[model samples]
Target: MRPLRILLLLLLAFASMPLAASPAADTLAADSEARWVPFQLTTGNQIRFRALMDGRWVDAMLDTGLSDTAVSASFARAAGMKPLVQAHADAIGGAIPLAWTGLGRVEIGGLVRTGGRIAIITADPRATGPDAVDLFVGGDLLAGHALDIDYAARRFRLLPSGRMPFRGVTMPLRLAGSNNLYLTELAIGVRVQRGVIVDTGDGAMLTLTRSTWRNSGAQAGPVTSAVAYGAGGRVETDLVLLPDLRLGTLPPQTAELRIEGDTGFTARKGAAGRIGGGLLRRHRVLLDPRAGRMILAVNDAAWQPSRSTSGLMTAQDGRRLKVLHVMRGSPAAATGWTAGAEICAVDGAAIPSAYATSAVAGWSVGTPGRVVQLDLCDGNRRSLTLARFY
Candidate 1:
């Protein structure tokens, strides 16, 4: 990862801390073992250990995209929680009613008691795929601690101060719009200025909101391309070029960004975008889902060579393709290909629309016999042969 990306990650982790402690008083200390407790979510997704709520420890999702801490209504009820009030939440699925419940006391590892509220919503624990987990803890819970998450080891550490020793650069969290926080020092043009959710599930580097782009000083190009998925899904966006954007304190560089118009029903009011595989693949990121904090470690050697080709490459449904962003001068753009072209197969293998660009990075770039065939919806099904970027 570059210095700017590292700064953005640090800022994200720092943003998770609560602005202030809840008025309710409760004291709970960290566990003696201090072992990272992984929590399973209803989505069958599991994240590193965060803090424990009450005697029944709660695992958190550590999502930056969320503005507050959230809990499943059924999980809260099952945990014997009675909320103080009902709050309405607009999720990716739709608007759902939730109950705001307070945990008497919550602890993590060896951390002390911190009083806080949890939003309870209805969720299907079984609905999460085989690898999905059930619970999610947003940024509201991580106000006071310095967090460290190590995915390679599946371990996490939480420190009480912001000055803890770490290998990455730390940056400030800049409030974008109403409830969004942007990591300042990242590459230019990349406007991940929304509250970010460190989601490994998502494939893109930055998921931008159409509103954010309109409000931003960044230059907006044309809606040169479109990406469609299996759920009758299609995203229409323009290629954005940010000249002097900042993530934190790190110097900014020119960056290629995507400006998505509407994410169907997935777009919400509070969050502007998401930081997913596109960013994570560039660094070693650790997330304390419970605490809602994260740490990003840049592997300069790993991605230094690929930095030049970052936005030039496209991945479709996990398959790397030479698809172009019709508007931008992408590799596919030079071939007279436009965006919204359906990438049917790579090397004759059928590719899914959900393919992540990072997954395709494993293949050597510019390797011959690496053909990318696509099926377009422009009335004429077209197939194009493309090369990988080294």
Candidate 2:
């Protein structure tokens, strides 16, 4: 949370109100209770949960990085919400305007908060359809409760304040500003960095600030480039494999580390990086702001880096499959394939057009050591054998 960019409209009397009338007070009055709610992992690797917003059922994401709860602008318009105040949020790439409105109530798995001010923002284009996420529940709304996410079971639970949901290793969660968000320490090969933000909204395993990554002493390895979309806009990113990452007393694990270029959101005061859902999915995570700790219980003992065998990441573009990234040292990269190259077909099968309802680009990650032929839009054909790049 930062200073306001502009004031579009205001209701002076209501402007002084808090988000939820002190969630801690409500938590203290209630006994220990837990309610399990199912969630879905979107294609982008985000946590999507079913929630009730103003009595209407909608999809929501549990995003600890956000300071306040928000609804998609389309959802706000459809629900006939009136904006009370206007502000701006500094996001991944830059600042984004926000319109504050009040939702009568927002509930997820029986954990309800009322009379809260919600920000109206735009949703990603890929997040559409009847089951798309229209709401994002942030730290401000869940400050009083504990969040228990069981990634293996694809479920989440909300516990009353002071309730330690699991008996597991814990790490200190430090408050970041007045946003109710937190940062925790992360050890990368014995070099401890204490400014890692616990961000469930992000899909990447770990993202480091350019300066932080440069000084991390990471071992040399194959590097890949990719694009990410967020609040400000699209941003180019570089990815690498990091070895020996330890969280609290957990065993060392290998994970993919993303390096944010200049203009990325990883730059925060005294912040080293952000840990997102990609790595958290391998463990049962408990976030207790009131307790000032985050607990982790390993569900998948064999945690490994998520890498492409073919070293290629493609996206649907018009009537062709656009090569968005090619991992250095990968089979695809060895062919000198760069970004913006279009493939008209894969293994002789025509690539799906942008308007096609089905995805037929499965050949992008075919069996390892198996040869897949790509027909380029330039009327040239190339073949490569799938193999682990990093």
Candidate 3:
């Protein structure tokens, strides 16, 4: 009788405790403590943060697509980092010689990565906006941790490594590659199992190299030729609607993706294609690199419907603005602007590199009756009748 009373009293005591007082709950509560620094989520969720380099604040961009930290040569010199070794980097334009250097210290919102390695690209990367940055914070710096990226709220925070919060879908992240970029199994196609980089900087829905697309056995349907522009200048691609595209067990997403027929750059094992911010913007993403897991709180439904198109993507060349990717059935495509087609002039007047971005939208969208003249590097001149919708 006494033992029964004691058991009853213990049950009562357990029931009277707070809801989240269990051992597992306590561990979760304890692990949730992490330092989260606020960052300005600019266009396309480009992570822009100020970092202390050589006692000076420098603008930095966190690009998950790269494995090693690649800093601008000018930035390296400015930071007083000397050349450590001779190196070469490959871009859309091809391989170029560069110098490898290291910073004394890279302080990110008070978090420090000592002796950060950097590759000095002689000139600015292709995708530099008006506010060009000095650094590319790659996975080398972000490895072995959980990063929670909230696109809608523009929140970017870091969680404890190897510890996952019990919220959102968790997937596997594989780092078996020689590089530091995290890889995961996505349901794109069979032949293309590994080469997908989970990148937030990429604005496209899905981008696959020619080999990846061929391996996937995805039949080429009625398609439009496009030029995909990135840090590497331009890639000629085919833009088509992948009706049977799926990401793991998630509902098959019909995406108008770009297929790079001629990817000038050599991608590593997990580098053929990418799952970009175009798809990731639909949810609150949590990336646990340490555990190789991903948690997604979906804010958008799947297989909804059609959206608008820009049909035009451009990149900056030395002193010229060139057509990097022209969506098939886009305003630029109709004008026969292939990859490497330089925009020597806009409306018959030469435009500088600094004003190149604004020049495209201002002259094309909603004008209805403007002609953007082009002077191609291939020595063929063409004129594009401009209209809205890319």
Ranking by lDDT: 2, 3, 1
For lDDT, the strongest prediction is 2
- All candidates' lDDT scores? 0.43, 0.68, 0.56
Candidate 3 local lDDT, residue 150: 71
Candidate 1 versus the native: TM-score? Answer: 0.53
Candidate 3, residues 287-312: lDDT per residue as tens digits? 77677677777777462212323344
**Which regions of candidate 2 deviate over 4 angstroms?**
1-34, 123-131, 303-306, 317-320, 351-362, 377-380
Could you tell me every candidate's TM-score relative to the true structure?
A: 0.53, 0.84, 0.70
Q: TM-score rank, highest first?
A: 2, 3, 1
Residue 122, model 2: lDDT of: 58
Candidate 2 is scored at a TM of 0.84
Residues 1-390, candidate 2: write the lDDT tens digits.
111010000000011233433232222224325467888865455788888876889878877777777887877888898777776766664556677876677777757777646788754443222245688877777766778888888988778656676788898886676755668888875378887888877767788887877776767477776556555555567778777788999988788788886455667435688887778888998888678889999998675433566666666666787776666677878878787888888788787553234444445445678888889999999887888665
Candidate 1 runs further than 4 Å off: 1-59, 77-84, 91-94, 112-116, 123-132, 150-154, 174-203, 209-256, 262-297, 300-390
